[model samples]
Target: MLIIPAENAINWKRPPWVTLGLMMACVMVFLFYQGADDRKLDAAIEQYLDGNLLALEAPAYEDYLQREIRFEGDQQSVLELQEFQALREQDEQGWQAVTLLFDRDYYQYLQDNRDLIWSVAERNQWSEQRGAIEEQWISRMSAFQLGLVPSDLSLYTLITYQFLHGGWGHIIGNLLFLFLLGFTVERALGPGKFLVAYLVCGALSGLVFTGFSMGSQIPLVGASGSISGLMGMYVAIYGLQKIRFFYFLGVYFNYFRAPAIAMLPVWLGKEIYDYWFAGATGIAYMAHAGGLLAGAALVWLLGKSWLQVKEEFFEPEPEQQDEQFTRGYAQAMASVGRMEFDLARRQFEALRENYPDRTVLLEHLYQLAKLRPDLPEYRDLARTLMADAMNRRQPEQMLDVWNEYLSKGEAHHPLAVEDHNRVLFTSLKNHDLKAAEKAFERMRLKAEPDMVQEACRLLLAEFEKLQMEPKARHYRQLLRG
Candidate 1:
């Protein structure tokens, strides 16, 4: 029968590179999904302009218009007008009965109406000039575009509209929340799952906002709906952990701990309070509430997996079995500090018997032996400890013991390196010549002139030693070159 140790049971920690790649993949997916829809809308608009008015009603017209105007702004005026003109021309072509059904006056009204045309034109111009400024401002608040009636199940407005925002403060605030919470949640969920959570939260929030607002024309923007999901995950995972918060009043700073679960209620309560009493100025409380609910549901579903991971990787190891030996060793150190050598020696010897495999303790035993070298047992013990320390890779400690032995004029063995070098220099000094040779080889491989020149001195030294007249003379000429 075979039994595996508890420590080897599971791996809960993900590699940092894996986490980073997941983040990049999430960013790419978001970009591609958003881009694909935009391209589809653009193509539809183009086809409508190319005498296909029947195609106009087939697509989500308002959504495509909103996304185009929001993203392209004034820069897209010419394209927008072209599409509009094509739709008009296609209406005259009778491609669809609805196009012909509209009276000449109504059709002319759409064509001659400068207000709608200018509205689109101005939107296009404004978007082109201030796309960056607008994006920056809109990233802070909870926002969503109008969803379809009845089912309210749609993707275009729900996805792209979340990327739009109301103003600078809203965008900054939302991005700040995302930056703070996103990294932690992403690390926990992996990139793919985190992104799925984000999109779901945004879609849910949009659905709720559309239901409540109905005819409201306010453009929605920001990443707050998704950030609320991260907040929910934080609460679920670290419910028992106390969160430290700081507040400043004039020159004084106050600090306190709010139980992790309590922050959710506090946050929700504030949003409710602001929505009812403080006017519709700061936050989108309804969308936030919707996002919070979605997040809670997601956490409940995934909490068990997260908990298992946490338990496996993060628990502390139990204390060592030889507690008494460790305590005696510590006490011996304390006795040594007080210069009670005899007491220290007695405590150390007792520790040595219990922890015979611990080489660190052996070094301490060697030092104690040196202080009492008059005893033959002390000398024997020191040599045994010194040899054990060297074998265990405690080189510095071994060197210290070796120096003490040398000073006392006792029989001591030198390390291998002491034969070639006068005294044992650091590993670097011994390897310098070898390193230089490798560097010279690399330079010759690359055909570098400076490398060839540097190798001349090394070559001359080797030649002088071997008394190779021809090779020495050749290196001499190369050095001059």
Candidate 2:
């Protein structure tokens, strides 16, 4: 059973190398080191099930069954002790009877001795299993050394335990979660801070688990603690923004989109419910819940930049200057309607100088250039805006100014030749061939000898790329002249 997020709630400026590196490390560790443990455990269990007495004689082999029955004991397993007695006292067929009983549906195993001890036979069987595991010290020694145990946790296991896993499924499930949410959190908080936060959260989650299961001897491993922290940060940063997720439960699978923050309650609720009712199923649900709380708290305490988060999740409103310029420009236009051209011109120029937003100022200048072309201020401002737009490589803005100039019937006006060439390049780049032709005409009429030759050469190159032979030939002839 897996729930995978489809997309991140935040976008990053660059690739998340830290997240990628962690994923690669997990894969390498699992492939080379952890896979061996999984294979050994599987083979040992299979051999034991086959009733091979020689297989059971392997050094510390009884430790596996002892650990399984101790931490993973249940009422059903207590009943299976009858068959174990029958096998030892009667025949190999008795072991076969118990093996068939073990094939029932998976049940959450309890650690309670009372639930597993109903009769003297069950009690003896449980005691024998516990003694056999304790007698063989070398069995699962590596796991015990690396894994985090609540009762006797070593200092190094705080970090090392997260890198270890009981099986391939455990490691892979955790890595999938880390990949999806880790990048989003890492992007929100930079790589340096994110790394620090992740480690701290995982340690804190372990401590939290220790507080609840203080006396338990079971060793906890896998990256769920750290990955859960990333999920917490993800919820904090994205909040109400909808994110997509894909979920699989055996053969039934589906994808859905929902608010990223909405998962917080659902995930927390499920963990809490499972921890309360599920009863020691070998899953560290409390660790996951702790990581969530720790991650969200860390993000809140560290303080994500509200502006940066909002930029990723929401659309920005219009700037203050735009609204102010619109209101002021309307007043200036009303003055022009009353034939107060001098007052209107004065107001427009004052507003243009006072307003810091170039976009709004350019727009006002365009309107003034159309209405009061006699004023040198209006025409001069238009030229400044056109040049600025060209330098900024803003084709739409240049077209706005050019169209305004043309709208006022200024066909023969002495605009700069460089400005004409800029408009030509911008128009063609925008795929406006008609505007490009108009700019070429203006460039030819106003350009000096040197400027004309440069323009012809540039246009020839551009037209050749566009595969327009006629236009290319026209520029070629111009270059020849």
Candidate 3:
């Protein structure tokens, strides 16, 4: 029932509020406004089935099916009608097989041949019965006005229908799609633009469905139209870029990497195929296809100005990058062996530009920067190496590099509050109490109060072990704070 991108996990640093908010809105609308709709519709239908209206309409409903068998000239329709007739004959209480709705055409059929069908009094009674049923249909079902009826759609109902749903399965499936596609698109376009685009696509999907099903009384209700647009926008934003996709093909569900743009056509084809072959399955397949088109077109029109694609979401795994650069890395190391530091530095710098998180590369650059602190790039490499306390492969070397740079009277960039706390632990790992003491003082500025307290406790214990009374006493005073 769904295909979604599984490229990026949730980043707590940037929560997708707009996506969550939209999901909440859909759920709340269903609970508060649409919840009673099902019960009300059932009440009206129950009344129709229990009353004389069923006796009158049952034969007429059968006549409508017979006409389909005679005129439609299709094996599918004929087979379906034959099944219906067979089901009725097989069951004793079989008249219930004829399900009735607010079918104006069938009502008109009854009225036009009133003499053949019934007497004047009987016709009047039939009219009164259907009239009473119609009244119950319109008034009792609370969500009837909110749904987008194709024959009599209003501007207000066009958008409102998207928020309304038929039942639990419909709303749950739709919200899952909204969260999956909406977050990335929202992160790209931002909240305001994402909301605008979502509404526009939903409206367009309604219009597209109306174009096909105009003059039909059935109301279209669900967020699928809007969500389909998000699917389109997702592909458009990452066009031609290879990204991991999780797909389901009826019996199969699996993931593979492909250009994100390629999925748009595949998704469109599925919806169009279902529309052609599924045959009155109640899903608005055309609306889904239209929404996908509208979403892609909106992003394409806005171009880069509107869509800020985050490359990290679609980039290859680090192992793939490592494999790609292994030969280049060997060449750089060969240059280092030949004492061609300038050429080696150039090659490492090039590699760092693409994969900055490569720890071995950074360690090599730090070593190179030590050999040539006179160069302008040493300051950048030194700052980069020291700031990332997360690169825990070589903490002793990093502290030594930091010390040499500062001892030479070079200006130091301050560590971020969180990084400063991490570096405190890093300094202690190397048994550099003097450096840990400096890190402790730097962290005193604005690090988490809890982390600072923990650091004081740790320093007190470590210094006491070294029989350094003055350092231990200083930490004791800070811990008291």
* Candidate with maximal TM-score: 3
Model 3 lDDT tens row, 409-428: 25434335665566678888
Model 2, 195-274: lDDT tens digits are 78888888988888888888666677888988888878787776687877788899999989988778877777888899
Ordered list by TM-score, greatest first: 3, 2, 1
Whole-model lDDT, candidate 3? 0.78
**Which residue ranges in model 2 land beyond 4 Å of their true spot?**
1-13, 35-141, 242-259, 304-381, 389-481
Q: Please, what are the lDDT tens digits per residue for candidate 1 over residues 1-481?
A: 1110111111245433433443444345445433344444333334333433433322323334455567766434345445555765665433332322222223333334425544675545433432332233222222322322223345776765555544446556666566556655655566667767777777787777667766443555556666676676666556666765555567776666766666676666765676566543536676776676677667777667642224422333224435666677789999999999889888887877767787767767777777755656555665575567556666455445545655552433322222112112221233343433433443454445664565667666766776978867977887886
Against the reference, the lDDT scores of all candidates come to 0.53, 0.68, 0.78
TM-scores of all candidate predictions against the true structure: 0.40, 0.54, 0.69
Could you tell me the C-alpha RMSD of candidate 3 in Å? Answer: 10.2
RMSD of every prediction: 19.8, 12.3, 10.2
Better candidate by TM-score, 2 or 3: 3
